[model samples]
Target: MKYFACFLPIISPEKSQQFRPQHLEYLEKGRNEGKIFANGKFADGSGGLVIYIAESSDEVVELARQDPYVSSGARGYEIHEWEMVTKAVIPK
Candidate 1:
């Protein structure tokens, strides 16, 4: 599997909030299935990011399309392959 970064720009903050529950559930499922590496929204509130583990861009795109935020039209998305040459350390 490879990493794909999904850029999700908020189209409607209201809609995003409306569907946030389902979207969180979807992310949780993906996490349990090992399809998602990490996901969160931008602090600036412009958008969100999801790192997915998949075979190809096409595969990731298909998976992303199922996100409640995308399916409910609360957000728009683009998929790109990500190369992780480094990791950030989170200090305790």
Candidate 2:
């Protein structure tokens, strides 16, 4: 499986706020299903970001389309497929 990081761009602030809870719920479910490796939102509160491990970009796109935020027209998003080239371990 490959990992893809999706960035949501808020389109309708009011609709986004209205569906925020459902959107979170969807993410929580994805987390439990082991589809989401890690996720978070930007500090500026513009939108959301999530990293998902899936078989292919198509799968990632499909998963993202299911998000309540998108389905409800609360927000728009962009998916960026990533290749983790290097990693450095840091003490917590």
* Per-candidate TM-score against the hidden true structure: 0.92, 0.89
lDDT scores in order: 0.93, 0.88
Q: What would the per-residue lDDT of candidate 1 be over residues 2-46, giving only the tens digit for each residue?
A: 999999999999999999999999999999998999999999999
Worst 10 residues of 2 by lDDT: 83-92
Off by over 4 Å in 1: 87-92
**CA lDDT of 67 in candidate 1?**
97
Lowest lDDT block of 10, candidate 1: 83-92
> What lDDT is obtained when candidate 1 is compared to the true structure?
0.93
Off by over 4 Å in 2: 85-92
All candidates: CA RMSD (Å): 2.7, 2.7
| Residue 70 Cα positional deviation in candidate 2, in Å, after optimal superposition | 0.7
Which number leads on TM-score? 1
Clashing pairs in 2: none
lDDT of 2 by residue, 1-92 (tens): 89898998899999998998998999999989989887888889898899998999999999999999989888887998888665777223
